[model samples]
Target: MRAKRCVYVVTAVLPLFLLGPARPAPAADEPFPAGRDRFSSPAADERFPAGRDRSWPLPGRPAVLRPWAPPPTPHARGHRGVDLAAPPHSPVLAVASGRVSFAGRVAGRGVVSVDLSGTGVPPLRTTYEPVRASVREGDEVTAGRPLGTLEPTVSHCPTTCLHWGLRRGRTYLDPLTLLPPWLLHPGSPVLLPVLGVPLPPPA
Candidate 1:
């Protein structure tokens, strides 16, 4: 019982200990340099949009069902974000290190939003929807941390899909741009017939 209590203490305090003051917003004209990771060093990462290709397999190798289509004008009819098809109840994850800004139900769907540190004046935010949250607002999370599980209900896509949105202030941007080119354009993957099969004891 004492050991169990100690484990809980560690879990609770670790996050607080790791959380740092949010990095300062970048200058208006200085743009994010090419070839930099959005979650990399504070000096280089600022001014870029948030998220990463590291989430390529989020919730289990999700496929892009709908691409981000920016509207010609705000309030115009256009898809605001990309939608990725994944099985219901699959675990959702944060694509980069950030602080949770929101985690709860909106309307009838679950949503989670994280403010990426050092993005800009408003700070770039990444959002996910149809997710039943496991993290809470103000919680600090690292890249690839599990934030929740995909909710069973979905509406944006014909099939179950996770809607990923990213924005700075009121303007939405391409979430994929945050990724380095190599990852964004990785060539088609080689097929593997079987996976996770352990070899028999070496002889």
Candidate 2:
């Protein structure tokens, strides 16, 4: 009887000790492991500091009414960049520091492109369209630098909006990903603890 009682206690007590304390599990949408930034990426950090090059093309950080929608293929129909709601002739700003590769007309629509060659591989480029060029080609510009003014021209949005784009060679990337967390509405991530079998109650 004594040996049997001891066996039961040992089984129960050992399980409690091994079970350890309960903690929240990692959320499904958590981007980082624990202490890292939610939108941090090593590749982005190497090119553009986390959230560094993310200024709205329009003044006052205008709302992005239409988001980026990349096409399945290069020729397929798709929205390459984000469409920020802005008034006609609104000042357009550069999202990052770079040289103006092109600041001229394309298909009757004024366009501006900044070459981000110093930042990353495949030579990234940021383009703003339907904008009257204020800076000339080969001019160096900094973040928030006035590139041009929004011009009323062709746009994917129903209303007047600045079409902001990012590209790596032939591939177009979502410009919002380059923006800071504060500029976006990626909501708080939930953390859940790793689940293990529940330990039996202590005898």
Local accuracy by lDDT, each model: 0.68, 0.70
10 residues in a row with least lDDT, candidate 2: 28-37
Backbone clashes counted, model 1: 0
Model 1 Cα lDDT, one tens digit per residue, 1-203? 66666665566556654654463332232133233223222232334543352554274456677766544443344566677888898888887778999999999999999987766678889999989999999999877889999888756678988888777766567665555544555565443333343433423
Estimate the lDDT of model 2.
0.70
RMSD of each: 17.6, 12.6
lDDT of 2 by residue, 1-203 (tens): 66666665576556543653453321222122233112222243333556455666777768766666544333444556777898888999988788999999998889999986466666678899899999999999887889989997544567988988887666567676666766654455443343453544544
Q: Point out where model 2 deviates above 4 Å.
A: 1-47, 51-53, 73-75, 185-203
Backbone N/Cα/C clashes per model: 0, 6
